[model samples]
Target chain A: MPGEHSSKQYDTDLETIRSKVLAMGGLVENQFQDAISCFRTGNVAQAEQVIKADENVNNLEVSLDDACSHLIVKRQPAANDLRTVMATIKVITDLERIGDESTKIARAAKSITERGVTTINHYETIRVMSISASNMLHDALDAFARLDGKQAIRLIAQDELVDHEFRSIMRTLITFMMEDPRTISGALDTLWVAKAIERIGDHAKNIAEYVIYIVEGKDIRHTDYAASQLEDRTTN
Target chain B: MPGEHSSKQYDTDLETIRSKVLAMGGLVENQFQDAISCFRTGNVAQAEQVIKADENVNNLEVSLDDACSHLIVKRQPAANDLRTVMATIKVITDLERIGDESTKIARAAKSITERGVTTINHYETIRVMSISASNMLHDALDAFARLDGKQAIRLIAQDELVDHEFRSIMRTLITFMMEDPRTISGALDTLWVAKAIERIGDHAKNIAEYVIYIVEGKDIRHTDYAASQLEDRTTN
Candidate 1:
């Protein structure tokens, strides 16, 4: 049977992987916020910056994956330690995808800005959705860093709000498109921005779920919402 | 100091995990095809079936993951064997998400069918996109089963075709929505179906990339399309 390495080097390696994940998470959060700002200000330049910065996030993911693999091979951690490494591997994938979604939002912002179309009324809804999603991402990373399952559970509840806001924005945009055919292209781009934000929320939820799995050794994914809610209440 | 296990049990265990992944892939492909047929026939019941079948995919993913963890702990596989197991874990995630995407498409189809809207002219485009995506999923599974890196590289090139078809369908749907405001809701649903189909193609490409990684021990993901195409030509 494989035994966990009793060396300080193994612990340091694990900590390094965790720290890298947090740094990557921080970069993704910044990218997401920048993408939202680009949407609000119609700043194609800022959007371009966000798009350009995604390469760093991608590099970070590769390095983190390598770190995790090396740790697994060298240390042969078992049980909870192994779970942490596995969860880190999974979490980085979500973080990298979140960065990709931010880039998509940035690209949509650039497209809409170049079209010179004012978002007008729907801007507020998009703004609300973006803020909620960004906050969820921030909090999820915090929970991961702290290994706080309770905080992660609370973050899971927030995805519903982000999703609701996304649907609300979609409805308003659809109405705007129907009222004026000229707005269809810009409105579709706005819809895509909202969709991207909503997906970020989903990735955040995935992270939160991973946090719970790492902390509690429970597999709560795809569980019914009511059951999850009950578990949240009971656990907390 | 870990030596490769030369035991038949180790080989059987690896074979079992591969079979499970292939079974999961088969289920996801069926779900995608069923979702498309539901769209074509406007059968809400069939769409519901697709949605309901997703639980099986989720279960398969969990079992496959657990089996992988057990294999890692018991066999302590190294080198290419370790990469194969790691790739299997990642591939199952993509397959499960593909099943989820199929469920999303089925849900969209149900909503559109309930609206009593016939897809009419757009049906052919959506059908073509779905078939291409389904074919990619099939080929990707075959590549994984055979450990055929060259075939997987060829499969990666096919994603470009699926993407092009997705864009064409989107443009047609956008035009349809703009021409008649009444089609906005249904057209939006159709756009979502096309988007889900596009995502399935993406997940298939991910599986193919994993196959190459397993066979060649090289990380080719996040590389540019031109580079991947050149790799495809050179590798084959």
Candidate 2:
């Protein structure tokens, strides 16, 4: 009776934790969107909202951590189940960091708005990069929810595109800086936002790696594209 | 007899894991040093060495992961012993990421060196920032080795210095861009190096958090300067 009772309780607890992780992920995703929108249109109020709402994201991280430890101590779930829980714990951390990056962007946006610095020609590149990175986030989370390795792999491939956009943005900023030194502050702020978007892309890649780990028990970390090619050749 | 044999094996395995973590820490420290040197003088050979030596760091990470899993499964170490092993597992990931950041710096240095870019004046700032970040790494790892929350707390406080330095560097780059748009490419490279160093400071802060977790039953992830305040409160 004790065994049966405890097993049921663990199942319920895990479901709750999963729901909470998803909720936190949604909150983080929204924060990114809000933060980017504020930067795009110079919406100071929206940027302020993003900065103020960071506490919610921070609190979610703590709760998620507590749930992870409780599950580990109580259920001691094994293999794929263990991997899933571990992935949840790790992704929550990446999400929390993403939240922080978004806050950084929002703060930058607020500063730019207050200074009445409206000559933002390079932000178009930042906007495009933001959208691309956001798509990576969506795909990574979708893969996680479905436990699909192929989707995760595709998401990882998208990361390079974001990197390209980030580099182009840097080039544009450099050009701007060369034109007028007074534009330096705005350019640097744009650089921070671009960097934030790049970090979001990195976190997306991290989630994709976890997806592969959970699905295939493959430690794809530090592994090159050639490893897969070699595996394909050997199997064939 | 099984219990006695298990105890001896556990002790041996734990000792091996401890040694492996220290070795990994040493490799990471070396990479950071080489990366800074590469940045300082465009040392392409040194940068290549740092890049090529990344494999050793990866190997250490995998070995540590395997050892942690094996120990947890076999010994089922409880309380402080379990916390110690978990901390080791967690800190290695942070160390490996630090190594990755160093690689990034090396790459940036090599790229600029390839372009034969000059006229950068913030070289001193970059040097100072790298040293400050490396010092933070040393302090954080020392705190881990000694399980000293007080030391970890102080090391994390020092992260603010790195942040402040990064801001000043950004301002310098902005000024360069504003004065002459032609200086954009070199300034961007400089910005990337500054960012890589700031990221190292962040990883050091993360290691400090892990150390605090190991020494005290606390989660200081989202808490504001909680680790530093802990010692003062306890003393009073």
Candidate 3:
């Protein structure tokens, strides 16, 4: 309790930076949702808006990263505090990458709009998958903010669903291309959009993994343990 | 000269970490090269080898990240030293992602081999584009290792050529799918491989941008100015 006043200030600083990361996460989620809506509704203006908003999302990443670094240098907090700062840095990086994938989705949406979205009517699959990926991203951010390693592990399980949807979309598109050669161009466009969405899920999973690293001090990427070992470990 | 000796030790610590990062880069480059060769030569064995090597690459990432956090906490490095550590963190993240992309390429290679690799004869464009992207990654690591901002800018310019190659491959595949429905499945397989290669270039470009950020303290990502401002800045 001797350092009580400064400790309170440190907590406030950490909370403020975490809030900034959540803000960036919210922006990226919007970009992804709007990109999907553009592809679904053939709204060229929305697609263009999403593309322009990506710059703002990127700027947020740069600033938030600098904030995390400044926090480390100024506070020089040891152990858990240092891990928290490092995790925040990694989370913002994933958020920025999710924004980049959203831009790709927007670009593909614009192309599909130009070609007419009628024949390329597989937007339903994209819609479902994007909603799932967007939600994963949302929960991943929540997991990071709350430091709930349990919830983070659950999101990792959900990424497999996204991957399954991606393969399903690919199969449907390939069949469409084979049936009508005229749909090849539009199918390819839609495929690109789906691919972007799939990548968003991967980024979200990465954010969740970072959360577990913060909460549990375990790096579970490139492995299945996170999604598997969720039962008795909480008691430990 | 009072802090000269300690400062020299700090420089050595920085160099040692940078050397580890470059070693990781070399390993990822080998994974990418072997992945492409696996696809080109229809060698399932080599493809499996590349896939297995991805785990080692991932392990290296986790260990290197821990090392970086230790450096920051122990050194309490400020200003340029802090930036170097941060940049190294970012560079390794990109390299790990490149390893993931290489795993995708190797998986696609294995799939192509199982499919007899005969009808998916678009290997030439993939080979060309992959070589361009691989060289970009190599130079990006060199830029990071040498702290060469100018060379980093050059690598960014070269990424455009890889993009061009990707677009060319896309066009050719779309035509192939349209002209003969029989090739639709094969075309899709090849497209996935092309996409993984295209993404390798992108991750490489991100590494280059980080190089510029470290050397010039400017974030030039999602911008064209880095590649354009080389000539006049030498005097500055």
Candidate 4:
């Protein structure tokens, strides 16, 4: 009770920062999903919308960064509080990057649409990868909001599956380009889309790592996924 | 003189952190250059060396972050000092990313070497782009070290040239893949290498922006480059 009373304003400041991060996360998730939908349905307008909405993500990042700086200056937060603020700063960066990846996907979708190449069958793998990556982003944010290290670890493991899917799709696209040179343009666009989704998965995994760092005060970044998985299991 | 005496230790701590960041930047620049060399010469051993050197970059980043955190906790640096530390933190992230991009280029070089495709004629453009980008990175780090906002602004303008080279390389690679399907795999590897180099340019640009922020207390990030250029000209 003594600690709670002493730190009311600090807690409120942290909460405000957290809410802003979550709001930004929600918008990034929507941007990613809409980008994928545009790619799947060839909706040029929706792709343009996704590109335009990136400004909001950018604005939120700037504001959140400013708020974090103010909090650190005013509060001089220590230990866990400092880690929490640092994690928020890092998380917003990954979120903003995810937004950029979404923009890349949307731009690729628009280019493919403009090229008048509507061969939809080749995109099944990309669609699946997009959904998986988006879900990872959603759950990564959930884990962060809940401060659930275990859930974050699980999301980190999921990155391998996304990577595997990406490799498989890349191979398939290469083969398609070799079989018929005419498919090169469309296949290249699909390849960019897949790369964007893979990058999004990477950003999501980075967020999960930040969550673990926040909750456990452990810097688990740069460690191999399999090694971290072993550590996660042994600890739990 | 009283203010200087009071903050002597704080200034020393900041200098130590800045030196670590410069060391890390030097290593990253070497890694990027070596990776490019590996690709141009098809030297798998050099490619492996570049990949191995990335561990040092990663270690440096961890120690630098720890040092920054310790300084923040102990000194509670305010205003310009706070901005300097924040910019250092952000710059190190970009430096670490440059290392990662170098690793990607090295890996791509190894793959291309394995493919036994030593068509060096097509790599002239990539070679020029790599040199340009490497120079930009070197200058950007020098600007950061000097806290020269004008030099940083100039580096930001140079990013446009790197981007133009990247797009031109992409178009040429695509054309090569379309003309000769047999070159598709090698072309893809080269594409990844080019993309990695382009991303390094972006990271360098990000560092320059951070330098400007540290010196001018202006948040020029995420702003239009042309607008910033105009501002830079008028201010000078």
Candidate 5:
């Protein structure tokens, strides 16, 4: 139980840190949702709000890094608790990257607002995709908090749906661009937003992998780490 | 110096890993160059060649990772050696991603070839941008191998030029799309290739930062870890 004592201490620090990371994750999720809303309703003000909030998101990421470093040094955690700490570190990196992608989308949204591009069919599809992606992000973080491997595994499977939707939306946008020369700039802007949402899905999947790692103490990055682990346990 | 034995072990292991990474780096550089060559010349066979070569590039990355891990365990290298191993791990990751981006560009090229989208402009700009980006990747690796902080720092500064060229190429492509709706799909394809090139530049910059970290024993990721280290050395 030597590792368990360290686990309890690390878990206390990890729980505190996870809350902060989730707060940042929530901010980034809001940014993606609002940026899409900005494009849909021509709410330039909402886009501007999203842009302004980026600095706070970035500041939170830096603070989270600082806190993680201090906790690692103090706790020197191991095993499942160690995986949780590592997961928090990596999840924040992915979440911070998601924030950057949101900022990129917000920038594109601003440009489209300035150009006064009319709403197109693809924009609505993008909005729907963003909602689904945001939901995945929420579920992934919840799975992380609860250490729910089943939920995490389910969320990983759902990521493919987001990718499929994104490709379909890209097809529609490209088709619109092909039919009208005037839609070119706006189409590119929409493409950027879609790409951002797709990346958000990637982050959500990364979080899900972390949940699996925490629950199973296995690496699931490249290989079918999760499936193999499940198979091993059943065989045992 | 007691450090020299560890340094020699690190140096030998580092040299072995460096050569392989640079080889992989060279392969990616060629992929971008060949991908665009396929585009401009409508070389379907060459596009296929680039696509096929990606597997070798990916395999080299795996080899590089194995080499790095092996060295870390064998040498048990401290601070500077540790930094070099860490740098190798990260640089290879970047190289692998660059390979992925290059493969995407190659796929776009093949698609363009299959669809017979013959109208291509701005080839001169794209060529120049790709070559410059290719050179940046080389320079970044060279900087890391020599531990040349000044050269690494210079490469970081020059990343802006890649951005400039990429933006110009994008603007030109958009203009083409605006002039003729028929050009929209081709323009979108070209835009992704340009984005891929830009990301390679970004990865190169990341390698440069790692070079700074190893040379100065500082963390230059977000904070000015190098600048503070320089100030400390000066004061001492």
Candidate 6:
């Protein structure tokens, strides 16, 4: 720390941007976890806190974007280094959107709480969905940090499972609402929160696609994950 | 077209990029319109076409992204020109997402046709929402072309109206589902299509935010459009 050469400052800057990307990812993960907790317990205060904290996530996105632009302008990095910076730029955006989804979930949690909590069996599917989505997000950031394309592929496959869970949840909720029309309002709120979790999975999958793009220079997006999931069903 | 000087080719490059953005926007708008028509008329053939057309949108995104990267690396543009490139990069992502939403709506249309459609009285709100969201998208693109921040703000306000329509549609569908359990499947299909249209509005709103950013050189994102929409309720 004491005798670093000025010539190595560029490496330091790149390292700083990388660490900040992870920091932003960490903040989003915590926000999502807190939102899930608030939904589980119907804790309005915690939900409000999650909403307020999204400002920090949004702020980080703006600052990191400016930092990346400055680096590009100053360094005029070679192709490889430019790819790294570009990947970082894209990753923060997905992270920020993940944070936005968390806020939406928090608001859904608040709305569900006000509408009154339903029995656990009706919402057990939501817990499963939250776990799947959160894990995909954590793994996505991990893959980005390590630049692991193989693991990103696994995370992308995991999204199909989340999609399966979503369809299952929607079916279950539709039946729930049909059996008891009085449960319609609460069931609708649950649907919103579940939809938010599914969107979090989508954002995580997008992050994984960026990881693959960085590692292999392959663009794997717009590939119809739903069609793949359908194939998964018929073959197995 | 053949007499242009080489010195003005930089402007030409930027203009080419701008026109491509609009072209992509037009393609997405058509996809959305076709998907809506499919839903309105139960036209499965048109829905399939909309789904297949998304590949073109995806290809345009990748090529434009590469073009932007090459421009930045080769030109090392100054701040103002750099902003245009960055904004174009972000705007295309939103347009691609809008295209994806159209595909989703197309699938929903196919599913609805299989489930059998209800009479028109139930879906009139969807038509209104389609117009609102589509207009926002068209105007957002025009704002980008003109660098008009004022029009972007107006488009932002219009997103609130689309959101309002979405909530109304959701409530109506819930009531419809409750009134007759036999209609549950059809109503759910309708719900999905409505949600996709609402998301198209959000994508358009995001494009408007990028417009404001380029015009004002200020970050106007994550500003709680929903909150302002709420304020618009009690005061007026």
**TM-score (0 to 1) of chain B for each candidate:** 0.92, 0.91, 0.92, 0.93, 0.87, 0.88
Q: Which residue segments of model 6 deviate by more than 4 Å? A: A1-8, A117-121, A223-236, B1-8, B117-121, B224-236
lDDT of 3 by residue, A60-134 (tens): 988888888788777877765777788889888889888888888888878877866575566786778988998
Error of 4 at B50 (Å): 0.8
Candidate 3 — which residues are off by over 4 angstroms?
A1-6, A231-236, B1-6, B231-236
Whichever of 2 and 3 has more DockQ, that candidate is: 3
Error (Å) of candidate 3 at residue A14 is: 1.6
| Candidate 5, position A136, lDDT | 93
What are the per-residue Cα lDDT tens digits for candidate 3 across B144-227? Answer: 888888899988888889999999999988888889989988888889899999999999999999998888878777677775
Residue A173, candidate 5: alpha-carbon lDDT: 85
Best model per DockQ = 3
Could you tell which candidate, 2 or 5, scores higher by DockQ? Answer: 2
Residue range A1-236, candidate 2, lDDT tens digits: 12433366666787798788878888989999999988888888999999989999999988787777667656755443555666677788888888999999999899999998887645676878999999998888788777788888777777889999988888787777667777788888888899999999999898888888877777677776424644575799
Candidate 1, which segments miss by more than 4 Å at Cα?
A1-7, A119-122, A225-236, B1-8, B119-121, B225-236
What TM-score does model 6 achieve against the real structure?
0.90
lDDT of 1 at B127: 85
For A47-153, candidate 6 gives per-residue lDDT tens digits of 99999999999999999988988887777766656666777788888899899889998998887777665554245659989999999999999998888877788
Prediction 6 global C-alpha lDDT? 0.83
Better of 3 and 6 by TM-score: 3
Candidate 1 on B104-208: residue-level lDDT in tens? 988987887787777453567688888898989999999999998878888898899999998898899888888988888888888888999999999999999
Reference-based lDDT, residue A41, model 5: 72
Give lDDT tens digits, candidate 4, residues A1-236: 12522456778998999998999999999999999888888899999999999999999988889899998888887755777888889899999999999999999989888988876545585978988899899999999999998889888988989999999999999989999998888888888889999999999999999998887778887888535676868899
Q: For model 2, which pairs clash? A: A177-B177, A178-B180, A178-B181, A179-B181, A180-B178, A181-B178, A181-B179
- Worst lDDT run of 10 residues, candidate 4 chain A, spans A1-10
In candidate 5, the residue pairs with backbone N, CA or C atoms under 3 Å apart (3 or more residues apart, or in different chains) clash, namely none
Report the TM-score of the second chain of model 1 against its true counterpart.
Answer: 0.92
Candidate number of the best lDDT:
4
iRMS, candidate 6, in Å: value is 1.5
